[model samples]
Target: MRPNIVVIQADQMAAQALGAYGDPAARTPHIDALAADAAVYDRAYCNTPLCAPSRASMMTGRMPSDIGCYDNGDDFAASTPTFAHHLRAAGYHTALVGRMHFIGPDQHHGFEQRLTTDVYPADMDMVPDWRRELDDRLQWYHDADAVYTAGASQATVQQDFDDEVSFRTLRHLNDRVRANQAAGERIPFLMVTSFIHPHDPYEPPQEHWDRFEDVHIPDPAHPEVPDPAQDPHSHRLRAMSGFDQRETTDEEVRRARRSYYAAVSYIDDQIGRIRERLETLGLAEDTVIIVTSDHGDMLGEKGLWFKMSPYEESSRVPMIIRGPEHLVPQGRYENPVSLLDLMPTLLELAGTDPEVASTGSPEEEIAPARRGLSLLESARRERSGRSGPEDRDVTIEYLAEGTLRPQLTLVRGQYKLVVCPGDPDQLFDLVADPSELRSVADAPEHAEVTASMRAQLEAQYDLRGLEAEILTSQARRRLVAEALQRGTVRHWDHEPDPEQRYVRGDFWGALQHGQIRIPQGGAEGAA
Candidate 1:
């Protein structure tokens, strides 16, 4: 039988910060130990860097464009079939215990249970307006003050929420274990224990903050950000994020860096507790554990603060999979895989195929997931002491708050391409310049490679049509958001169904078996 699945997902954590990833500043002993026993993917990235789109992609096993999730406000259509639905169809109980950053009202998204509501507002309030200029910034944009104001916090809003997430997850596990024991059954579970720590506001708990007190935190490789006028995309992000308004001293950067590292360690501590609880219940041996982040923090790298840009710091995420010793392979894989692949990957682990599941959906809407290969199969091949088939092409999309238009990234092996409106194409050779300080698009030595990648990107995406679709989406969402935010706001926030009963019938199988037709503008679909 397939083991239970536990997803410990983090927010805004960069791959560079983990000791497992060779960061000297991180105090993540727990994560390092987990990596030692798990299979690590060195080049895994989120298809879209922003919170909602990337997370939506991971959940549904589809690209953001496939699901029409361009920004945080883009509602993840309930019509989509998620891995939870697949697992649930296979008799696994699914639950989410923390922040999923789901914007719409239908927050359960196939999870049989959700322990808490999300931290961010669950509406179109955060919708980005391309028509709005820099001075007319969105209300949700970052303040440079967050960097300057960084320090140890006795208590913070994020810490409190994550603490509750951890508690609820542990309590849920204990409940399940005892309930299963009393019932004399080892019921399967797919639990997502997510956390919002190690995200920005860069203020960690005082104790975890003190743990890194003596650690030397380095400033961003290029602390001097580019001029906004010259690099419109970078400048737009910098200005909208409010980084353009402030001049900070070295002290501010150091304080922010230290706090971020401490924040990572704080979450690492929580991971230890959750893992210990799983072991205590004798579930570790039969559970498949996954640790990853939605996206990465810039941490002042290249003068960027948060995700949204196509830079490596913002695009890449950390991923580790620790499954049953006989199943999961150890050691690192240096090929490019994406969070977009998670849906198919998890589905395969649960003993179903994405190809079959794609055909199972009522409308056959699960196409993008079929595009990604499962890492479970790949890991098994690697365990036999042979290399697995390599997929070099990774497609990344950006249509969030930062840009007036859309952006795309096509990464093939060492050369990565980034193309957006108003900025010249950027191509970086990661093997040659890992920091991505320079774009060799203009170099004659790499003309053929750049041209080839550009052709691939253009062939893959229709820029004019894609931009039109995005604009239409933005306009529609903004119009709806405007009329809805009158004297009273109808919240789309998901409240956990207090009656946590598990229905035995397959959720997806009902669709596959054609027993139920998914309703149009389903009860939960309307704003």
Candidate 2:
């Protein structure tokens, strides 16, 4: 019998916010305890720093760029092979409880069932013309009122939503176990409990906020460098209207950091509740629990607030897997791994073929052209104190929001190179400057290192068949214009509306009552 799987994924969670990962202010006791029984991957990264693409990559085990899911609004091709589909075909009951961000008609593409649906903004599918005409743009929360009041210092915005998601998940788990027991069938279920907290609106419950009030939040290891010669991308962020000139005050930064930590603690408490329930139901030993995040947040670091950068603060995430002692014991692997490895890894653990199937229509080609080895094999090798043949240098690439060119790529054994698309390159020696505070691309003394890293980056681009030519200034501007017109463009400066103010929650209810036009197209209307 294959072990049941429960993947608990959090949105926009940074590794530095976890106590196990060395956050002095963190209080993730449940996750820390799970870490004691599981193997923790210390250097896991997301294929894309943003939500939709990163989640898409994890579902497909392919790079976001490869699938044309380069930005937030781009929908995953429904026909693409997904890990859940593979497991479902292998006779496992797979279900997604929250926040899949499928963005299209075929939301439940792989899973046998979905417990919740359409948690993202409905306007994501609005027609291009309608999107262009709208003054609010793609901002969902702009029309809604703030969830937290001006005088309220607590992180109440996110707590209510997080609690609801957790409640739904626990109910599903308990019901599943009860049904399986009554039928005398072994429960081979794969349930993904995804939470949308810590992503934005960085608010937690009052209790959680109070817990971190006295904790000291440290500044980023490398503060903002005012050198124009450093990296053009950093300068680009600094040049944006609200983002460029904005510097977070120490009090505001501390408040934001405290809210973030409080969110983590809140999630941790929910995980504890679920774990206790699992133990009470006797599913603790047999079920494998994997906890991770889609990506990390900047949290007022480097004068920047959100993800979409190649910096470690945005790219690196936390991954902790617990269960099946014979398969994986308590340990920590520092080997750099990408969240793209999760699909194949989970399939392997479920005793199913990790390989994608080749049989499907043109619209349903449910297999990957290129696939990597499963991380489970690496875990086994690590447990035995041996190296796996699958162990090789990993490369991570990032493309700026509107630009089609690669903004950054890091080769594991070598150095990291940041490309400005049409500008000069920036190189950082990982050994010397892990924080990437200095650029050595122009330093004559490190000519050999620079050449080596540049060559490696070029080879990676060549292998991937990415366009090597950079976009012209006019072309870049046009691309941004097109993105703005398409409603795909997103600006982080606009604060998210408070959770209580989501009009969609009530608007969706109204749709059922025939209060609004049952438009020609799906949820967001014609487009």
Off by over 4 Å in 2: 122-157, 238-241, 357-371, 382-391, 400-404, 444-449, 462-527
lDDT of 1 by residue, 1-527 (tens): 77788899999999988999999889999899899989899888888888888888888867788788888898888878888888888888899998988877688888988999898878987787788887677677867788999999988899899999998999888667655655567788899988998888998999998998778877798866754444578888888878777777788888998999999999999999988877665677788889999989888887878788778888899989998767677778876778876776778778777665434454654323124657665565555646532344788899888788788888887878888867888888898998877788889999998898788777767898999998888999999889988878779987766743344477764343322223364422111
* Clashes by residue pair, model 1: none
Best by TM-score: 1
Q: Write the per-residue lDDT of candidate 2 for residues 224-247, one digit (tens) a residue.
A: 643665555555544431344345
C-alpha displacement of 160 in model 2, angstroms? 3.3
Candidate 2 global TM-score: 0.79
Worst 10 residues of 2 by lDDT: 142-151
Query: Which sections of candidate 1 miss by over 4 Å?
Result: 227-230, 357-370, 380-390, 497-527
Give the backbone clash total of model 1.
Answer: 0
How many clashes show up per model? 0, 4
Query: Which 10 consecutive residues of model 1 have the lowest summed lDDT?
Result: 518-527
